[model samples]
Target chain A: MALRRQVCFALYAASRATTALYRPLLDELGLTYPQYLVLLVLWERDGRTVKELGEELRLDSGTLSPLLKRMEAAGLVERQRTAGDERVVEVRLTAAGTELQARARSVPAALVAATGLDRKTLVELRDTLTTFASTMDIAAQELAAKKK
Target chain B: MALRRQVCFALYAASRATTALYRPLLDELGLTYPQYLVLLVLWERDGRTVKELGEELRLDSGTLSPLLKRMEAAGLVERQRTAGDERVVEVRLTAAGTELQARARSVPAALVAATGLDRKTLVELRDTLTTFASTMDIAAQELAAKKK
Candidate 1:
């Protein structure tokens, strides 16, 4: 079908393809795709609140909590209450989790190869998507505020 | 984080953003974002095999089967075994599903507005994503074949 004109479908399809490509590679690392993403966020910064991880992943606590629990069970991450406020739960990577970064170092390159695109071209596409996502987020926020 | 360099994250985040923007509009229509995608495919061609639908959406039977079941229950679509082949199920949009198309006409425009990008720019982005996804699919198939 010539449904290529639908921007949303393009994004959705491409996104799924990306995840599929990552699946086998990540399965070897004992990480699901979402878990890999959570690690990506944590690798960049060691300790983040569950709320912050949720924001980065655009996943609600309902989804993120169980994922963190699984990662904790796998010895990848640990979630504990903050010293200053027991109510605040912070998610941190364990030594094992941190070490996964070394294994994961090749993931991006493997993903790029899977796309059959040069790194330069993929970089440009990534930046464009990132900007579009940010713009979409702003519009969604404005719409929500208006509804409130 | 310098994670913007990660192409997968950009696509993942942007795809989520697009889905989030579609969520409220789709909720009003009693459809989820993925259901809307299914309709788009059917609207282009009235009936298709479950396998075809799975391919078009890049979803596995495990996922597509249950989704079609839910859509059938919602009266948006119907699935029946083809007369020539009892084993092959074909999905066709119900009258309600067909009518939903007119209502869904505005969805693309609303999504474009949400992205806050000119239609031309978004079109460029869509084409880029479609090509990238196709390339990735080919690469994946080759890798799978090699592994076999």
Candidate 2:
């Protein structure tokens, strides 16, 4: 079978394409896709620890540390070492970060508009993606277990 | 709606997860995910131009330039400006690159063995992803047309 035509290939392709779709819009806002993802999580609930954010984003500290530092420098978020747990750093949105949320609220709508996919189709796609993701997660965990 | 649980989010999650699945295996061969993807494309067919690679990989010059440069630096691929089109760069595998193919051939089987999803589940997931990707592509084109 042609790898290009494989379902896994399509998923990978579409994911990249979708992220690219956000590029122009996000560039205007001075954000990368991962940064936007972090912002989204923060906007939804403020003051999440580094570990919590990493778990939510499925990113490791190696990637997240510099990213959060950059975000902190940009004045979008504040990172403070927790008093209770000195080892833990908490990330909370700054005023600018919170304000950015209002601007970002329109992004998803713009993306849907940009994609031109109907609402129903988008929902269906998301459902299938969730199913695939969950299955893959289970598969990865099982693989990891066998290795140990 | 929970933006975190949306199809776009799930798609992004799955894309990252897929790469993570490949991380340890690809690391053994000293390749990053994007680098591995480039090799995957080239393994299927020998010489391809940068533009062709970008199209197949769904990456633009901004992302591919540095990536290809890194690959070229690694001695896995050689980049030469095509005689016919000075603007075009063609990537051809080096001796090391060709040799790496033998090492990479086992990757698919390893991934399949590592991922515990049954064949039936994989097939179903693949079909759903294919449909979702095709529909998304159609929508993207339509949106582009409307803007033009």
Candidate 3:
């Protein structure tokens, strides 16, 4: 239990630190961390269905739907339904969204400067976390399968 | 950028996983994760000031104040103003709160069983995460100190 607490605490602290680093940067661009996450997903692949974004981000519709609506209001992204799949909502980046990328390009450097973690530590932490996520993802899936 | 995403993903994922792991167990005790966190702090040392609890949990007064209010309402804890300092609100567990430990004792085992993560992986992951958090905490303090 103590060990689990330690790991959970690290993850919690790291998330807060990362958000703090991004807070100032994203504020300049008028974005929150979760909003920025949505933009990142769209940046990687434009015009993805809302369900896809939910799955990729591991968020449920309850969280994403409202978030997407807010993003739409901010004009960073647009949501539209395809003629064939009226039930599905597809999200696409606006011209402003694409242009915002150039401004956000410096975010990486700013985060590095703010975090003050050495590259070695960052890489190692990332690798370990990635592995942990993969393991958890598999575990969650297996557990679901077993329930079914 | 990929590295930052990895770190953020890990943090977000781990937070969700930890909450999920605790949810069912906590439900049996009628506690939420944050509420459980509050209980844990009081378990270790009753009569901590709200400010102290906020610091220990890395939460802000805005968040902890309301949470403590709810916990007080739940009859798990009581908030008293310190005689030495009128500004301080001391949080002490109630008889009900202290007795809850017996019920919560088995929660950690249930969480481990649900997650299905091997003990070895859990330990290593915990160690790595703690190292990461300690390093980042130092860096954050140094950064905040510089700002001051």
Candidate 4:
């Protein structure tokens, strides 16, 4: 296969593999991979608006809305419309959500050990992928603009 | 975020970004990204059994069965239960499926340009991710075995 084709498939397969590895771990926490991601962002800095969270996660409201609703139902997060701006809904981690972070810390640790790659190698891989994703996102935006 | 947390998110985001970039291109071809991947494997060597395709793609039967059914409905491929082993369903590219390969060649070219990364860097990244995914898969299996 061409390098370009292999690159995309590699990323796709790796992402799914990572998620599959996390499945059992997250299941015990009653969270899915995406839900865990939302918590990761919240754990970093809580009380983010829906738009902010969407921007960080590269997820639109159409996808985030239902996900947030489910998270709220699970009692991990609470969404409240701002009094100052009714249109803006802020998502805050619940007490349970905040408490879950301590346990969630082990997930990444387990994953790192699972990869068996040295810290430096993993960091380089992460940085490269981050830059790649950003470049692709820009290209996608330009393509969408051209379609308009 | 710690490097550990960021690594998984990086892969997750990059995979989605890659898929998003392919969305428009594949849409024109009336193929979803996963479906295109299935065709890629078939084009390489047609008449692969469902099990073989699943192994190559790292997809389970639950996922591949429906996907193959959709592709069959679209006349892109045909699936037949082998006479020698009725349980083994072999997937072969149809005339349309084989012809689509010509047009599909442009996809990787477009993606390469979109990413703006040098071919060498992309190739290295692909190789690393493929290995990373394989390692994680083994870890997941080990974890599952421990649970049992």
Candidate 5:
């Protein structure tokens, strides 16, 4: 099969392309794509533990730790160990991060406009891909279990 | 729209999920996902210039240079300035790279099995994403032009 025709390659390319489109927009907010995703989760619900954020983002601590560190250093977020549960590190958007949400509201609309795809089509495509990812996650678990 | 329901986030999550699925299969080949993508292009057609590879892969020189360097160091591929055009650097697979193709063919199959999606569905999804990406590219170009 041609690399271009491969489903995995198509997802890989489309993901990067979409991220590239967001680059200039997100740069104005001083955020990278993944960092922007982190903020997206936090914006939806604040003060999530690292485990909660990782589950929502499907990212492990290895990847999330340094990224959270960078976001904290940028003063966009604060990470605190919970007093009741010392092992749990909760991430909360700082004032700057919360304020940035107002500006970020325009991002999804701009990205939708950039796709030039109708709302129905965009939603359908997203739903399909989301379902596919969920199926793959289940399959991956099976594969890992077999290995064990 | 909720962040979880956003089309871009769905694509981002799906892309990473699929890559994570490929991780173990690719690890056996000593290849990262991007590096495996580079080899996919090279395996299809040998001796492509960096520009050509970048165009096919939609990667900038900065990202491609280091990746090509790593591939070269691993002895999977070689990069050299063309004798006819000193400005052009061509990437060609070494013997090991060519031989690795036999082992690499299993990767796609393994990934397909892991996804648990039938071939037809996978192909259709891939085509949809490819077309979506192309449309987004044009829209991005228009957006840039309007800004100017």
Candidate 6:
């Protein structure tokens, strides 16, 4: 198990490196990586429940709650309890948050360029990682259940 | 720019998922994911400088210092300032730390099995990610310079 060549290390390194690359690009737009992700979900479909946001992002309430609070403070999103269900809090984009999308359009192309791999290879890698994540999630669930 | 299809998102998800998979495994050894990474580096080569560990792990001193302190508290590592250069702190594994290697041996195989990938595909993906990380690092440096 060479540390340099380990798959887990590769994933950690690549993900951090990608985040580092995005730092400057996103900084111009006043967005942290996780915040950008939250925005991405809302950009695709506005007014998702905080529960739905957490499920989509694989984040827990503790983490997503504070993040959403920060986003609300920044005027990017506004959270409200649905009248029909007080337990259901929905996250909807603000005018500024929705308009930030126009400025954020350049972000993805910037990351693709930094990858240094052609479109097809990058797409393949993304799809493979996505599949690997699903498998790992299942494994984690099994491991957690076995522990119980 | 579909959020689900973004390479950045895939990388983030895969990395976090892998870390989750490693959580229970590492917890059994009383180690966190970053702590496990430190042990992996130390297992390969003992007594690396704090700066060296930071570079190897791509962590800033602010992050690494507390981690090393925690490891020291756990009797897994000891840090000493070099006699010749008091500025440099060396991290050496303790007897307990050195012995933890044998226990950690099964950890890598467990992760690989959870991955559900054949050897060849995993190797290729690791190599690709390694290269991608390097390219992204260079891009980050250039962006930093441009910002200056």
Best by DockQ: 6
User: Candidate 6: where is the Cα deviation over 4 Å?
Assistant: none
TM-score of chain A of each: 0.92, 0.95, 0.88, 0.95, 0.97, 0.97
Put down candidate 1 lDDT per residue, A15-131, tens digits, no spaces. Answer: 888888888889899999999989988999989999898887788999998989999999999999999999889999999999999988998877776777776787789889989
lDDT of 4 by residue, A75-119 (tens): 999999999999999999999999999888788878788899999
Q: On residues B43-121, what C-alpha lDDT tens digit does candidate 6 reach at each position? A: 8999999999999999989999999999999999999999999999999999999999999899999899988899999
lDDT of 4 by residue, B1-148 (tens): 5433479999999999999999999999999999999998888899999999888888999999999999999999999999998899999999999999999988888999999999999889988998999999999999989999
Ranking of all predicted structures according to TM-score, beginning with the best and ending with the worst:
6, 4, 5, 1, 3, 2
- Please give, for residues A1-148, the per-residue lDDT of candidate 5 as tens digits: 5798789988988988898899889999999999998988888889999999889888999999999999999999999999998999999999999999998899988988888889998889989989988987887788788989
Tens digits of lDDT, candidate 6, A14-40:
999999999888999999999999999
Q: Write the per-residue lDDT of candidate 3 for residues B12-127, one digit (tens) a residue.
A: 76667667656656877889988888887788878899888887877889989888888889999999999998998899999999999888988767656655668887677677
Model 6 lDDT, residue B44, Cα: 90
iRMSD computed for candidate 6: 0.9
What is candidate 2's DockQ?
A: 0.43
List clash counts for every candidate, in order: 0, 1, 0, 0, 0, 0
Superposing all C-alpha atoms, what RMSD in Å does each candidate have to the true structure?
A: 1.7, 3.3, 2.8, 1.6, 1.5, 0.9
* Candidate 5 accuracy as lDDT: 0.90
DockQ of each: 0.69, 0.43, 0.44, 0.70, 0.74, 0.86
lDDT of 4: 0.91
What lDDT is reached at residue A54 by model 6?
86
Look at candidate 1 and tell me the lDDT of residue A5.
Answer: 77
TM-score of 1: 0.95
Give me the candidate number with maximum lDDT. 6
Report the lDDT of model 6 for residue A65: 92
Q: Judging by lDDT, tell me the better candidate of 2 and 3.
A: 2
